[model samples]
Target: MCHMTACSLLSYIAIAWMKMVPMQTIRSRVQFFKISALSLVFCVSVVFGNISLRFLPVSFNQAVGATTPFFTAVFAYLMTLEREAWLTCLTLVPVVAGVIIASGGEPSFNLFGFIMCISATAARALKTVLQGILLSSEGEKLNSMNLLLYMAPMAVVFLRPATLIMEENVVGITLALARDDIKIIWYLLFNSALAYFVNLTNFLVTKHTSALTLQVLGNAKGAVAVVVSILIFRNPVSVTGMLGYTLTVFGVILYSEAKKRSK
Candidate 1:
């Protein structure tokens, strides 16, 4: 996360240097409280997401994560008071049910890991809803790049203290590990570049579309994650798990269709 946020900040600075956008404009006068809140949400989503991987199989993790739209609707109403159509709301039923079934059926499920994944999912939803709320006003509105330009550093600030407290001697341990394997540095550099793009595109998507729409698109990505996890990692998945994921994805498709028809 440290590397990811730093890369995002530096990359935006490089964009400013290239005269693509003025540094001054990138440094928009967003409310301090809003940015801080956003950073905290971003940190929770990412930190808990990584933690979930340690205890759950990648396939099962994506299955649980696929229910983002369900949480998004809850947060949307709570934050923005923007209610979906009754039919659209109804479509979320299977989305919720599938995750419950999947969690029960997952052979590698850890109670703590499942909680972290659910929290991460909720944080992502909250972030999406909060992004829409905080950045919507004409006076405070920022384009995707400028918004990220502010968010990345704030995330770094919010995460550092927690990281130090939770992972004692992390700096020394990482240095020792790096000494044993210089390739670790290269891998970090590579992933840092990719993380910037992932974050950039997320903001871009949310900016162009509704927050729920962003969650809908995010839910669709789970199929690919599941496929790659099976192919590369050869993760064991039970029949119940596959059926549950199928039901979840099917429900998401129905929700998308309901959304389009409503529009």
Candidate 2:
């Protein structure tokens, strides 16, 4: 929470320093409401994502997140009446089945983690869809930096209360951070900078492509994360789980190819 807040603060400063244009791009009531709603969804999604990490093994968490493409497709279709290609739809089959199989076999599975991850995934999909819709209009589109400048502060506002209510070790964390070397502070600042860049890129992607595309990209990234987890964490995996993960990666690739052909 603190890190996110810091990132938002820095982004605002950076935007101002770069003279990124007027901060009044969110000009109308409807735009304000839409941006606010997206911010709230973003806050919940990120909070749940971090919370779920506490209870889930990194491997399982990434596996579940691979399902984001499925949720993205559903939300995009429902929200914008955007129809996916039949082949793309069919590819979702293995994407979902693979996640289920892998999750079922996960040794570190916790029901709470499973639920939180699913909720986060859904919220993330909704956020993506909203960003795509709200930012698609050329006349109303805010540049990626401006979008983040607005949305990040809103996210901080939305998340602060949750942080105060849910975080019990605030004082302990503060003291620990205080006692830590200055290097830790630099690391945190570096991480916050990276987070800002991530937010910028995410908004740019949603602005440039449909939410479904972003979600598909997420699946590919999730596949890479899964591989990294397996390598770094040495997670024990069942044969079924391995097959499931493999299926998911290939299915995502196929989905991307199918979407391109359809386009």
Candidate 3:
């Protein structure tokens, strides 16, 4: 949360110096409220997502996280009343199937971790759906960067109290971690920079495409991450799991083609 807020502040400074900040104004209280609410959801999702990782293997987490696209499609339809192509809907079948299959092969499962991961995944999808509605509504659209500039501060406001209540010796812990390894500071700075890019690109994509597309892309990203994990850890993969991952990639390709045809 601190990293996100820092990036937002840095973005604000960069835009201000560029003299482009004025163009990224919030037009109304309603819009401000909407952004704040979305940011709160984002905060919850991130908190739970990190917590879940402690109990679940990365592979299982990714498998569960792959359900975001399914939830996004459902929320987009229900919340935004956005109709998607039937083919696009059909394409998600294999995506979910593959993930479920892959998850079934997981060596361990914690009910708590599964629940938290699923909650995080659902909250993430809800965030995307809400963002799509908020950004696509009437009047001038908020600049992608500006939205982050505003939302990030609001997220920090919501996160601060929660952090104090839930975490122990936050400042001392951070200082201790940094003192133990100065490289940790550099890693954090690097992560913050990448996170800023992720937020900026996410907003841009959500503004241009439907939320479901972003969710689908997120699943593909998960698949890629899984492959990277296997390579990094030198873990042996089962044939069933490999086929499941392969099917997910194939489904993503099919979904992309269906989306183009729908357009």
* Model 3 spans with C-alpha error above 4 angstroms: 233-240
Question: What are the models' TM-scores?
Answer: 0.89, 0.91, 0.90
Instruction: Work out how many backbone clashes candidate 2 has.
Output: 0
What is the lDDT, from 0 to 100, of the residue 256 in candidate 1? 89
lDDT of 3 by residue, 152-218 (tens): 8888888888788889798898889999998888887888888888888898899998788888888
**RMSD of model 2 against the true structure:** 2.0
Candidate 2 minimal-lDDT segment of 10 residues: 17-26
Candidate 3 local Cα displacement, residue 236, angstroms:
7.2
Query: Alpha carbon lDDT of residue 262, candidate 2?
Result: 86
Clashing pairs in 3: none
Task: State the C-alpha lDDT per candidate.
Answer: 0.82, 0.83, 0.82
Q: Which candidate is the best by lDDT?
A: 2
TM-score leader: 2
Give the clash count for each candidate.
0, 0, 0
Considering TM-score, which of the candidate structures 1 and 3 is the better prediction for this target?
Answer: 3
Tens-place lDDT digits, model 2, residues 104-160: 777777899899999999999999998887767666677777777788788888988
